[model samples]
Target chain A: MGLDNVTVKPHEKLATALAPELTAVNTLIRERMASKHAPRIPEVTAHLVEAGGKRLRPMLTLAAAKACGYDGPYHIHLAATVEFIHTATLLHDDVVDESAKRRGRPTANLLWDNKSSVLVGDYLFARSFQLMTECNSMQVMHILSGASATIAEGEVLQLTAAQDLATDEAIYLQVVRGKTAALFSAATKVGGVIAGADPKIVQALHDYGDALGVSFQIVDDLLDYEGTGETGKNVGDDFRERKLTLPVIKAVAKADDAERAFWVKTIEKGKQDDGDLEHAIALLKKHDALTETRVEALDWAEKAKAALTSLPDTDIRQMLSEIADYVVARLR
Target chain B: MGLDNVTVKPHEKLATALAPELTAVNTLIRERMASKHAPRIPEVTAHLVEAGGKRLRPMLTLAAAKACGYDGPYHIHLAATVEFIHTATLLHDDVVDESAKRRGRPTANLLWDNKSSVLVGDYLFARSFQLMTECNSMQVMHILSGASATIAEGEVLQLTAAQDLATDEAIYLQVVRGKTAALFSAATKVGGVIAGADPKIVQALHDYGDALGVSFQIVDDLLDYEGTGETGKNVGDDFRERKLTLPVIKAVAKADDAERAFWVKTIEKGKQDDGDLEHAIALLKKHDALTETRVEALDWAEKAKAALTSLPDTDIRQMLSEIADYVVARLR
Candidate 1:
């Protein structure tokens, strides 16, 4: 399914089964975003939260909880908490990347300043912690907190690993898992734990989330290379930033002596230009790295579907599995 | 008492009471700092944690818990949590301030890069949340979360208010409370709450911490002027940075036509040089703003001591109270 088709199906299903809960999550986000003490906090936070994110993290929390047979009100709070954490990271990520644009809009760092981005990000993180405290489940807190640590660690790892030609599959997997998949896994796992699911069910949900997140991120990285003109970002943004994504890492490993020298000069030494992106893409093709990356993503998608075996058969679970398929199907 | 005398007394007391707890906190910090998945995390975090500084926030958590008559081991974990939070903020703060030096050492920003500082700071914050989750106290989580929000808010407020002379006492107090006292109060309050102290004792401890923190910060600002020969930092560091601190705020409020113009030219317009610092100092003295700031610090010190009435007569309580006096006494 395309973006429009996938989005429409979720909207219809969510509106019917999870309407009230979704409303509660939305209200919680707005209310918590309003800081009585610090007015500027909401202003900076609103820029991102109100900025047209898909609310994927929070949606995962809700979907996981519902799929696991949770009927309690706490899921909404957790969903909102997850969103707050995601938004906080976004604000900080823009500053770390020093990127001027996000979601095709001016970044917080550009609109206001880096100072606002940093502080408001901190405020949102605090708010997320406060929200989790209200759930009153140490297990929930533990899962979310662990996810957060992994996410931050992943980001730092990515930072240090950027532009290093010697980056490998093991390190790349860890980075993607940390940077993109940790929260996804945590959001789903927390939902199961909060719903009082069995240990087996919780573990399955965690694996499902982890694999789905990995697949999702791999697809995203692939899109940066294979995306057509209609895609929002350019094909070589990661390359422009000198990032050593899967394609470049694989290509570097397979390069001949002459190609290896070119890779070192263009990537490691940051001597790339627009023409270099074309050459890099050709190199990826010559080495069949793109095909391998897609195969890896498909494998993760299959793993994600397999991980759902412990859950009871339900429309939500089926849709989640389909969603996993939808994430990687775009590559084909 | 002089700095040497005060340092000796507190160092001995802090060592004796907090040695075991401090050791545990340090061990926990080291353990938590490692991200098995992200190799870059340790590289960025160790640049700051191993840079050397007194672990005061963690000690405060341990001290507060001890003073509240608790004999539990969980406080050590909580202490580590607060320290992680504090260190995380410091990392980000250096980036926000564009600072080159902290405690006579090169900042992470200067050593590694701003990217490392921002990302590693984020990692530490996530680690903090993880540590707090281990404590499993809703009230403790609530207090720390609130403090985190306030700290971030204060930072943003400071950013927005910097170089603007119109900032008032109320706004300034809010900023100071957020930037400094919020963490202090939360750290102390969480300690008491975790110890299962009475509500009254918790409130007393919280108030004591807030006032003491305010006094401590004021003394720090004063030392920017008073420590011309003793302290290594240059005099008028805040003035040069155009930070509208208490002394500068008061002086600006009391300025005549010529004085106001000079301030506008130097601070507001960023036209300062070597002679400007001397003139700014002379103006501060001319209006007795230093004395005024000193008196305010003493008032807070008195309030901090008075807040201890709810605590029983114990050596720790007395030392905490005296520590308040000793902070302000540095001005004399």
Candidate 2:
């Protein structure tokens, strides 16, 4: 139960450590998000970009690049690129999820319309591509663009998989990697790649980011069950949305006949009543699915830490390693 | 007024003229759209990509490249990249417009869902970026990425300006350029760039595409009033949707106080009544807006034709010139 090993401040330490670079990244983001003719670009993007995201992905980029000994200005560009991509995804995800709130504030889709969210998300994605190209490394472009494709693919897969009981851990991992870890790994990997690090070290960075993102998403899914975090909703938000997260997948896999019918009614048929969320949580508890999922997350966090061993023992690297552990530390 | 000047079959002649390149571009699109994990990608992409779009943007890439005397393999990739960008835009546009029909059938959003369309559009856009990167030309990426941003920015601008009474020709031109001409110009310019054409000639191709795209969109807006030519919607969709196209902008600019109130009631307030569309049409007719719009389209088409003269005289160039006039000729 000791908390000595974990760093509660995930992006906080990274932000302080990468202060100058983070400032440059923020400046770059503001400059790029501006539109001369269409003022709505900045308005919609500002709504989400200025909202209190931890700037975790962009920090990971800055940390990864700086820790690998890159001092060039392009790392700032890459960091901003990652942030733009993250914001774009959040905008589109809000629209797709019909989410009224994000970061405990009204979403752009709710404020302007779904149209603004969709188009502005696109503008940001296009902006991200422009930023990555500023790095002038085709290798970086390839990695980030590949990650962008995977992120969209992951989201589309989630759309279908979320409503199906046939989804399993394997499918869940793919979705998680696509929607979450692909960017994390790419964000970190491109950092090293842009820094011209060794292939093995870059691979190690990728592995670290992948594991961290997986653990982070697993904890997020778990938090939704334990009552929402910043999602600004009740516990079982995923259940209310009928998403097939790890805990429910495990629960459904082990459900009795009666429980199977309950899941079919709630998840498949989407006929949930007030008590359905309570009963769903009970079934997950009955199967110990939440506990198992937490253990898996911890395992991934350990892998993330292990991967960082290939990098130099810099302060930023140390922070990144601890951040991975903290990502899942909330689950415990 | 002679039918001999306008090739009744625009794409047919262009397709026959650019047969080999078109085949290769289609192959590249199919190859790139295939998802290793998500089957939904190709499913949704194919639903839109294969939905009979005339492949005009890609064809411009092919025609511009081939006409510039370049035999490079990357032109095919560039062509495919343009098509993917175009398809992606259409997908998102359908979702934004809540359009039930596109290309003479149900839109991808209608067949699948807004979620699929949004995610798949993101996928194709990413794929377009990926394909552009494979060309290993940062300049090409720069142009295409800029086009993508303009396209999205234009759409966002349209969302806000569509119902606003103050929207005028300048805003309408900006929107048209963003939503249509940016891609067309980028498609053509990249082709010439990839071919290592002369700087002036590359500029010429961009100019040609810009003009052609403007003329095409004007004709499209006109056809919506001249009774909907294959736009897959009934006449007055822009009126129904309150879209401030060029014709409507022209009419609004010339509106009297009483006419302004009619527009405000129908467009600004969405209090449309029966015969409002007919009254709107009569107002446009009375203002001579449709005729002036036709004159503007012809002027752009003429500009398009003039730009093509910079390129070497080849069959493809001739076809491109013909296509420009053909685009606006529909209105006449």
Candidate 3:
């Protein structure tokens, strides 16, 4: 998985192909994150933005635009805008999740305080809005702003849904779309829209991003339950947090009266004992929830690849398609 | 200040003059704040937005647009946008300040949790951005977005500066402009921009809002020290929180060595015993900081009125000018 390996990861390959634009996006991010009056703005944002998080969302923006024959400088602005939105969400998410660590490092909230995280996150959101306006396209602004609304709405929805026994797959999908897929779809759709791509092509880019994001999130949830020790995520962290992820939701749905009582106590009542995690895992296995979740993630990844078929067959597009497939490949 | 009183407050008078537009703005606010997916959004927002905070900022938008002879329907949207921004900031502010009360009610963070407050605040912010984009003016978007950035930057600055005794009047002014004046100026400027008013008229509106907001905040800080029990803000709340308002800043500037040590012990170290707040107030009087601060507020109010003289001499304009005077009149 290293950069020099022959079988380099899809996201790294995409980053290599979009190197110059990625550089421009990084420069723009550095320049924009600086505040003339508040030195803390850069300090808080730098912890997350400069952390090596693969820059996947922004690269998708650059890749989507380049695949649609966009040669203008605005794509750089859009890429940086996407990253700013991403970083802003991450900052707020840490505060919401009360997270102590992000990207395997101490989170901004831990380093400064929840106050800095909340306010600096706001500063990034404002910065993102300002950057999008630079593109001078109302259509782009419309899509990004709409995406922002959906993202926040999804998060609020998840807050209620994550602790409820009544939450089914449909509600889970809504939460996933709001928290994850909205930005992904917006990132890709705005790229094509800015490139003056045909409506159909832009629609295809949006579909690809949406499916890929869903697949990415499902796999992330799955990995938390099915850790290989290489992913850096502590297994059963979500369970300890009482968050009803896809696997737990599925297992609960298939639970009998006694198993339902277990879930009710552990999740809803939050009265789990030491062996409860082990019992939860056993129940997930008994119902084959992990396998079913993997199948769904793979299906979404396939849909993501299929949507990109209508895009130009450039190297960037090829890497994007592979990136979608790779998103769920870890499930194997 | 009651509606039927002939001596109705200036804001109430302005509200009477713009009743139809204000009604429309409320409708837009209610309509936009309700979320189809996240019921928590409306729940959390209604607790604050409907908590009777006077709607001063949105009223300014309506007044600015109507005074510029604009009869467009978009002012409703602009006014709603302003309120949404204000409400969103309040939501976040409560969480950042760890406040339990806002507008004489338990904060959303108290009723629900910090997570709900953070996410719902984000939703309102995103919703405001979407509402502004509907106005279809690049200039309006630029101004509002820039204000959002400034508001956040000022908040971050205040986070660091509030406890630092070295913070001067210049820094306090910058913080006030960011947290209050930025939105006020943007609210009024966008009204003029949406109305197709001349550049000079727009500048006047900007100036009026800027001065009014500064005066509004200065008087607010003054009330914290000279509380008549009518302001609803707890006297010595700012002192207890170690917030460095204008009077304290002035007093610190004129402090002797022992006075400086008292400020450092209370504000910098957050160590205070009984009568510390009383001593702080006494020091403020000893330095004549309260009188000086009151004079500055009156000066800003005068400037606010002076700026509005360039606009149309309508009843709405007269009410707006009166509102400016009434802001600082509480000091008398």
Candidate 4:
């Protein structure tokens, strides 16, 4: 759904390149998600795992391993571990966001209840840790567990910071760092670690994933104000939800007396009427916040691409660079 | 609070014997629960942690280590890790159960919101993994993560099996095994593992924790039907919640046609009226379920005490045996 317009989608290229490995990752995820005693565990897990989101994170893991000259099977295990963690977070996020739908379908929280989402999310997270431990790499466990903590801390930070009017860019970066980039960096870093790649290569992969994730999230935020597609989310959904996205934060930073009043009323207090969404968009445009946000996203994408300069020259490396470019391309 | 009246409290003996170590665990918990940016993390965690939980699980970890002749610093870390995991699960449990009062005060979910509880719980879980990794033991990691998965799976099984009349004691054991005993056993087993104890001693500690935990939970469930304490749980709370605890499971097993219809109307259909509580208790009494449940608890307690025969005959071991006996002593 993300790269439909590009004739040669970058992620699709990586997916095709690593198709066999990706298949093993998917199979491991399916095999591990099931509970012997609790049918509901598998039932709830299968609902989201089978929903067909592009397996971008796991592919990054595989690509990093193969590019680093790793041929072992543990990369497959690590890839599956990354996907499990991602799925678990999404499940919990649906409940936190009070989401009714995800990927154009009713969320598990809506279909079953919040209890199932919380427990099953927990189950998957625990399963992810178990998968990582099977690799016999304490470093992998250390890295993944640290990322897990960061991710949770980031979500909690967002919960506290999303509504406050005083949230600045540094705090926003921390929030995004915690929420998105932690897992991205961890996914790629563990791939290299598992492959026994050199520390320099592992660090390069980590830097690449960090930049790509930030760029990815920033583009996503920009798209909320820029386009409305059939990806199950509505235009101005973040606006109505009173989220302090990069665009909104930038707009509010430049707000005058009257405009500041509008942000406080709509965002801080959430007293929005029918015309408020249009008015918010107009303000974002007037402050040039949309264009500046897109530029920042492009800058991160460049960093992601540049991280690959020191890595081995391979088809997967080229595709990863292109993947970063394709992310912010939606905003451009 | 649980052992305030008993003259020879087993946990109190362990606490007195291991005061310095327990202090370290408490300090570590305080230091780790704090979030530099999100102050709400500690605020929610402290409300429960400082409410005086007797630190039973962490104490179990500490005692097992001491009994195995572990004179290292990592045991303190493991004890703190176990406590964090336990606290994290409780926070999520309160949210899942929609519980209002805990420890004679408002639950975190009630005070802040479900969002805060869920995210904060996640933070603690990740923090726990971080602490475990600090101990630098992969076997410890494997045991704890596995237990975490089983714990989540058990909660899910209980969620799905709670209202069904077809649930038997075997299923109940699996649920309790997952929900309660997994962590209990892992807590002690990891202590021995960290201490480099012999495998036989480690196995003994694992068996001891398992039976102790099972006995602990059965006593808890039985007490839910017998006592009303300042602890905030009311008698018959499980019945009101339509939970298929051991007593009710046994009662349902022997129900005649008329009784089955009654159970279906009250528990399955949930058309519970005013005398339903009394009637449920009467049915449990008619089946002599309370006495039989207490008997099962004693059997588990005996198994727990008997398992310690192969381990060192130290003061901690003696206290652990008494702990098992004291668990069922409440029912007696």
The most accurate candidate by TM-score is 2
The better-scoring model by DockQ among 2 and 3 is 3
Best by DockQ: 3
Clashing pairs in 3: none
- Model 2: per-residue lDDT, tens digit, A165-217? 89999999999999999999999999999899999999999999999999889
Q: What local lDDT score does residue A60 receive in model 1, on the 0 to 100 scale?
A: 78
TM-score of 4: 0.97
**Which regions in candidate 1 have their CA more than 4 angstroms from the true location?**
A1-17, A330-332, B1-8, B229-232
Binned by DockQ into CAPRI classes (incorrect, acceptable, medium, high), candidate 1 is medium
The best-first sequence of candidates by TM-score reads: 2, 3, 4, 1
Evaluated at residue B237, the lDDT of candidate 2 is 86
Cα-based lDDT for every prediction: 0.84, 0.89, 0.91, 0.89
Worst 10 residues of 1 chain B by lDDT: B1-10
Q: What is the C-alpha RMSD of each candidate to the true structure, in Å?
A: 2.2, 1.5, 2.4, 2.2
Cα deviation of A205 in candidate 1 (Å)?
1.2
Q: Write the per-residue lDDT of candidate 3 for residues A1-332, one digit (tens) a residue.
A: 21223255777888888888899899999999999999999999988888888998998898899999999999999999999999999999999988887767888999999999999999999999999999999999999999999999999998998779898999999999989999999999999999999999999999999999999899999998998766766788788778888999999989999999999999999898999989999999999999999989988988998999899888888888888867876665
User: Model 1 over residues B1-332: C-alpha lDDT tens digits?
Assistant: 33334554563577576788888888888998887766667776777777666676777778889998899889988988888888899889988988887767788789888888888888888888888877778888888888998899888888877888898777788888989999888888988999999999999989988998898888888888766544445567788788888888989999999999998998789898768888888988999999999888988989988998889888888777667767776665
For model 4 the local lDDT of residue A222 reads: 87
Q: lDDT at A126 for candidate 4?
A: 92
Candidate 3 Cα lDDT to native: 0.91
Interface RMSD of 4: 0.8
